[model samples]
Target: MEEFKDQAMEQKAQNTETEQEMEANFSDMEAQMGCKEFHPGDVVKGIVVKVSSDEVLVDIGYKSEGIIPAFELAFTKVDPFALLKVGDEVRAEVIKEDREGNIVLSRKNALFEEKIDLLEKAFENGETVTATVIDVVKGGLLVDVGMRGFVPASHIERGFVKDLNDYLKKTLDFKIIELNRGARKVILSRKALLEAEYQGQKESFWSSIQEGEVRKGTVKRLTDFGAFVDIGGCDGLLHVSEMGWGKVAKPSDVVAINDVIDVYVLKVDREKEKVSLSLKQLGPNPWEIADKKYIVGEIYPGMVMRTAAFGAFIQLEPGLEGLAHISQLAKFRVNKVEDILKAGQEIPVKVLEIDMEKKRISLSVKDAVDLQKPESEAEPASEEPVKEIAAAVEETKEIQAEDETETTQTTEFVSGNEE
Candidate 1:
């Protein structure tokens, strides 16, 4: 009985030892199988393990493998095989796991985080990066790098940006001006970057430019007297008179906003950094050909074009007009000039005098008519009329005397025949 009892005790002890060992093995398997605590939106590093036709498997230090979609692995410049191979390390984001399964991950979110990180570095270094303007709102715009960034409307351009839609999808190189994570504020400036670059380029361009260099420019802004042009980076004025060799009634007539044109450098002021440009220099001077075309004492057929307080203007050619001055309109005295002449009247005029330096011509209308000579030389005509009347009276007296003589002879002959 003692030997049997001893054997039972030894078996029970062996069973206990086996149970303990099994429990230890189960605990170790559970620890190895459990995934790490990875929250959604957390960026993490991973390694590519299996590249399949459908998907690429990544081990992100998690118990289960992470699958990246084939479409998500697309890269244009470098071959996908070159950018990603088996055992390649990469960064990714922790998207929530399949609730039914283990944790899931994304490469796009990781790329976004990387972009933001790069942007932060650029901000610290005062560097610029190109971004697309996604939306326009009141007072500002939404620019997109990886995440959306705010660009105040005031900072959209060198001055004011009227049409915000014009910037949409247009990538602009910009700099980060302000950023805050807690308040969720990010401000960007394209003009600030532009201004700095413009200053440098303008200084270099203006240094090499002189007062007589002709260049091509675009009309940026217009005013009553002139238009402003962006020559290189600085703005220069193209005055109304400089716009054309002919008369420009207003600056808008010759130049329109955003019109690309060529202009001559009229004057350069280095101290003020101001340049004066002329558009007329791009063409021949109309006045240079005026003297050769028109001469004094010559007649020109013209039409009344404009009525002024001083006179009616007559246009002989397209931009050249002569003033048929108030004093030269009629032969007789006139109370009002308009009473004798009206606008749009076709009239023959003779150029009495021309002043090329003053850009004026004196014209006359009355001098173009024909007039009769004076009657002071008619003394012989009066004498001839009186002598003809005296001759007629003398001939009448001779006729009467001859008729009386013939009647008396007839009576004497009749008396002799009767005896």
Candidate 2:
């Protein structure tokens, strides 16, 4: 019994020593954690313990939890409940100790530091980033690119943007135009990215386009002389002269804003990056039918559209016009074109000569008037005798009687043969 008690006491002492050693080791480890060494501006890694609407409690392996205010939780204002949850480990900056013995931490300051590092690498590599437009302020826009960034109005697009409100809630790709860690300012530009993309498309369009190839284009804008059409990648000039076969006094007369039209690629200057387009070239030329349709000595109807000092311009068709000299305005002499002819008057005109190459036709109004009737059709009333008129009428009656007698004889002979 005594031996058993001694062995039991020895075992109990050994167990107590082991327990004391463990406690000492645990205390040394807690001291080594150095929670007290954490000061303002020091970064600490912590796991989230509790999350509220406005604040987050984090366990930094310290005796007391660290409290992070909502305003200090992100690069911008944020709700702690939306960001942090229990058991989520995060890195934070220690601001100071509060009166409640809680360590004050700022997640935004820590996140700001991390984003600066990322931006430095991005700027060095010439990389592009995506961001959302948060608000439009004076002279520029505020965006979120993992941090608050300012994009000037001039940097929003290739041209000046009048309505900055259109960019609100729009997500766009941007190039980091300027970044400063010391100033804590980040500037972004969407225009730079668009320009780079257009440069590539312009090159491809220029190489693929061939003369005479038809392309669908949109009428982007109109000038006094032409319409600037956007044919996918580049703006092409569609001159008023090439709008159609008919005369167009102004570019707006042919097309309106945002009109879709098929245009022929007339010319391409790769060196200058210029394109010439034509809407008429896509259709058949009206001059092609002029030679076949217009014949010399043919009398056709034409409208007197306008009168010149020397002659009158008569329109035979939509694109075909001919000149009638003042001398041919009437059979008799006229002081002015208005004396015998008026605008919008339709009259028959004889084609005297056709110059298809020059797109000109010499028309004679007098000849058309003179060719009304031939001398063989009827003689003069005075010269015509009454006896000749009566003889002609009697001959017409005799011929009709002879035709009836022949018909009766033929019918009687056929009936007798059948009998």
Candidate 3:
């Protein structure tokens, strides 16, 4: 019985040494397998080991392979097999450890984090970022610039935008006007970039623009006094007075919005940053050859255009108007100019004087009528004949009335005597 106890003790010591050696070998194997401890929210890099429709398995130097769900592979729904394949590298964020001892990772979250860092840098540096417009929401547009970004309607263009749906699904450049990482809010402006570019063009335009230069322009808007035209990057005023050589009642009559036209640069005010443009100057000036076209003491057909307190304005032709003074409306005295001459009335007038320097022409309707008279009646009639004719007619009427009154008075006197 004693010999048996000694043999049993030796066997127990040998088994204990074998168990320690096995434990050391297991530790060495674990080290070889790269057993890294990962917790939730840890970012990791790995190579894609397996790609399936539902999930993508990545080797992240961990005991169990990292599992990325298909839904977590991107911000939007995507096919994992098409997006990733075996041996492709990827970055992911650790979400949690699953019950199967597998790591739950999110590739979308990792991409989002990286994009936020890049966007933050872009915002600080005033750099432009590209984004795809996804939806046209109320008051603005929703875009995906690696994340949800909003562009206000007012900041979408240099002017008012009537429709926001026109920008749907279109990719455009933007400047980050506001950013809040905590709230995950981002505000972008395409107008800011457009304005910056326009300002550069505007500076170049102002520097190179010269007076009397003809430029192609689009009518932007119309006001009571003029139309604002977009001549390249700058807006210039096309005044109503300069729209035509003839009278312009309204600016709309000359040019409509969006009409492309040629304009003459009349003047440039650099101090005020104002440009005066003209449309009529692109054509010939009728007043330049008025003296050659018209002669003094000659009769011409004219149409009454408008009347003033002083006289009536008659247009001999387009862009050529002369005033017929109230005293020269007719051969007879005129109480009111409108009584004799109406607007749009065609009449003949004689030019009495021409002042080419002042651009004034003195016209006479009475003189024209006198020239049209026969030579026998061409002599100037004296006022005495007119007064004598009126006086003699009044005397004859007075004598006939007096005779009737005397006959009635005599009849009354005779009737009284008989009584």
Q: Flag clash pairs in model 1.
A: 97-104
Best by lDDT: 3
lDDT of 1 by residue, 105-216 (tens): 6665677666767877988999888888777788888876766689988888888777888887787888899876555456899889878988898879777878888988
User: Can you rank all candidates by lDDT, best first?
Assistant: 3, 2, 1
Q: Report RMSD for candidate 1.
A: 23.6
Off by over 4 Å in 2: 1-37, 44-66, 76-91, 205-209, 232-234, 256-260, 270-272, 291-306, 310-318, 324-355, 361-419
Span of ten consecutive residues with least summed lDDT in model 2:
380-389
Task: Supply candidate 3's per-residue lDDT for 328.
Answer: 84
| Full-model lDDT, candidate 2 | 0.82
Clashing pairs in 2: none
**Cα lDDT, model 2, residue 395:** 53
In model 2, what is the error at residue 9, expressed in angstroms?
A: 26
- lDDT value for model 1: 0.73
